[model samples]
Target chain A: MRRIVTLLLALVCLAACTKSAGSDALVVGTEAAFPPFESVATDGSLEGFDIDLMRAFGAHINREVTFSSRDFSALIPDLQAGRIDAIASGMSRTKERAHVVLFSRPYARVATGVLVSTQRVADAAGLEALEGDDVVIAVQRKTTGEEKAETRFPNAQIRVYDREVDAAAEVAAGRAHALVYDMVSIVNLHAQHPETTRIIDTELGIELYAVALPLGSELAPALDAFLAAETRPGGKVDELLAKWLGDAERFRATEE
Target chain B: MTAQRERLVRGAVVMAIIAALAIVISLAPGEIRWALAWERRDLFLTGLGLTVVISSGAVGIGLILGVIAALFRVSRSVALDQIGRTYVEVVRGTPFLVQLYLWYWCIAQALQLHGLFGPREAAIVGAIGLGVFGGAYIAEVVRGAIESIDRGQWEAARSLGLSHAQALRHVVLPQCARRLLPPLTGEAVSIVKESSLLSIIGVAEITYHAKNLQAREYETWAAFICLAALYLVVTLPLTLLTRRMERRLAGEEALPVARL
Candidate 1:
């Protein structure tokens, strides 16, 4: 009799596991490498600028949010694998990416800049002049810098690294000529390198970071509606942007 | 001279095209953020602690549990023998993660075990998951090591007027332990690496740290590569130790001594 009861329970559980999961809790996927965007703190709490912003965005969408952290490059693959419903990393919506995944309207737009060493800036007039045979530029893998470099300095030697921090670190260590990244990270990185790298006015391209969804997801329309409603002047998104961006300035800007 | 110059120019242009393509394929905008995180010391320490503590604790507990089951099967008792067989077979048939998930997430929570443990109860869940999963393989190791002891050795110990307990403690156990060490160490290494899976329940081991770094840095590949290297750094010592022990055990006599 006891054996019979146990067998029946096991059968029920095996059946239950295969059922489609509903999105009661928003299963937001993120690659938590970007500080001030999404990062796991010392206390095991996920905190950052994007996290704060996402919390506000979730409220605007009338959804309770939860996060699954994965490798940054795996976000798109994870989303396609049905492991996550949406991606909230600092993903730039580009023409190539649009073919693979649907992106929401931009919540935050970051400017692009080139950070060169203090020593290099004294001699260099412009990027075109710096394109000598010895010039090597560092940038992150699978990001807009690769595309921008193609468009801007096709002949310039580009060195690719696994992450932005490493590439930027290379520049500070005098390993690369300069690093290309968004203005926010460039400004933040300067704190460590102490003006060893400086920004150049020579433009590459501007990318708008947006929330991404699996292509043809039913949830996309609903999220788009929320973004559209919130982006209106003095609406909830503006307030959230102010609050999150303001909060980040206090906590995120300091490492020590 | 003109032809050679033309060829040199064409060769230089080809190399430049290759370099340009390489930049596009490999370089991106966000690699530094993840790389810096991979180099962070605090996260590495946290992950190291969780991996060792969970794996060692699980293996220690599993050793005790597996021995008890293995002995029960060898003992001339019907009910205990059935229990051992059932446990070994069932454990072998199921995947470890499934068992772990069931133990920590579904069954324990349903039993309201979190209140019985503490507020941040995932650690207990992870340890217990480790214990249960570790026990399955440990049972097989115990049975094999014990059974490998010669029948003559058992009889010889008995003929010398030694108590059954004394024979096991003094004679059989030392040999079995020495023989089991390699598998046991392998199991330990496995436990440490496998603890990465417990991050699903929020253990914050190295893999979790890597993922967190990847999410923020958006440099997923480097973080994961660093994580892989970290795990190797942790396990490679055990690998060498196991190799040394295996060599020590290689040139011995039959049954309990060593063979294939």
Candidate 2:
């Protein structure tokens, strides 16, 4: 018991010590699994669209960039608690999120799509077509995909999986007719599982993905300036997105 | 010269294992991480609590349950015999984690059950899960020890006009105690290891806290490996104590032969 008390007190001291993170380095938060936006690449380096952009943005600001990778869900809470300076996870800058954190100008446009077996993608254009009271839709627990599934297909039975990869697998196995996820995730899914499944057309909940600084960050204005420089008047950011997420449309049009 | 040779061989074996592990941890690419290094102390403390709570809870309750269950096994009635067999078989048949999940998510999640039970959710689940699982194996060990008591001694005690309860309290129970300690010590070690499953239900036990550190810092390997080392530290002493008891009991047996 004395040891537990001592450990608790030590944690309190460590929490106190984290108040100052310094200006020389920027601590960037991201879920390294979300590809095109962020993921650990095949070569074992952290590589993705957001990663390249963040590195460039860090260079522009003359700050050394270091990333803390975690499950996507942890990114927002970490950002809100001031644990990281910014989030580069392909987090859609929702109006609801605007209340919690300041966003850089939209550096990447995002949209949602479905990863379904080719057969199911043939049958449905939207959630309503998928909801047959008996039909199952697999979605990641506590994600926007889950929320939309709940909102749109109220009658559809939902088996909540903890990760997007599992949800896509359910679709590929024909256990679930469809899966809801962001466009980047669907692209990655089809790329990985082209023989079994494919992504479908008609995006849902379209929004802008941005770099989020904490609520009332002194860094937001400067982040906005750099985002505009790269994306505002058509510079290298657009060209890079074209090369990376462009083949995504071909996957979206998958048949048979 | 004989002792020195044993010591030299032991030292070489230990040093070789350590050198191999050092190479693996160093050369494993992104697997080598320092992020969870900060919470190493916190992980140690939580693991200690986790070990003690499960070990003591399992051992303490296992003793009481073991006695009751063992009594049923020894009973003359067929119903009690069947009941004891069923309990032992059921508990022994399942894994500790499946039992833990059933207790934590199913039984503990029922709001009325939680409200009626005095202890907090995690504690109740951990206690019940560890207690029931430990009790099963303990029941068999206890039954074996109790039955091993010489039937002639029991007959002699009864011939002296002592009640069955008195025979148990004075003679049978004492004999059972020495036999039980060695196995009981092993059960305690298993209880400590089994407590790792409690982490899955968010108990803030050792593995749970280590996971929090790993997730926050992205140091999966270091956090878990160090946490495993902490568990070894706690359980190794208990394990040695148990082994010593076995040695002591072995010495007691040699005493009988010497007297003969």
Off by over 4 Å in 1: A1-23, A118-124, A243-256, B1-177, B183-204, B207-260
For B86-189, candidate 2 gives per-residue lDDT tens digits of 99999999988788767765565554333333223455557767888888888999899989888976887789888877887787878788988999878878
Q: Show the colliding residue pairs in model 2.
A: none
Ten contiguous residues minimizing lDDT sum, candidate 2 chain B = B112-121
Clashes of 1: 26
- Cα deviation of A32, candidate 2, in Å: 16
- Candidate 2 structure quality by residue, lDDT tens digits, A1-256: 5975786477445433443334347878877656666665322346777788888888988888887655566567656644468998777777777888888887766677877776564544554577688778898765677777787778988878754655776787778888888877787677766766767676776657788889888888788777676673346576667766774333221111
Instruction: List model 1 lDDT by residue over A141-230, tens digit each.
Output: 777876676567667788887567778877876778778877667777776567576667776656677888999988877777776766
Candidates' DockQ values?
0.10, 0.04
Clashes of each: 26, 0
Q: Please, what are the lDDT tens digits per residue for candidate 1 over residues B60-141?
A: 6687778888777766689988998888888778977788768765676676653344323455667767777777778889
The alpha-carbon interface RMSD of model 2 comes to 13.0
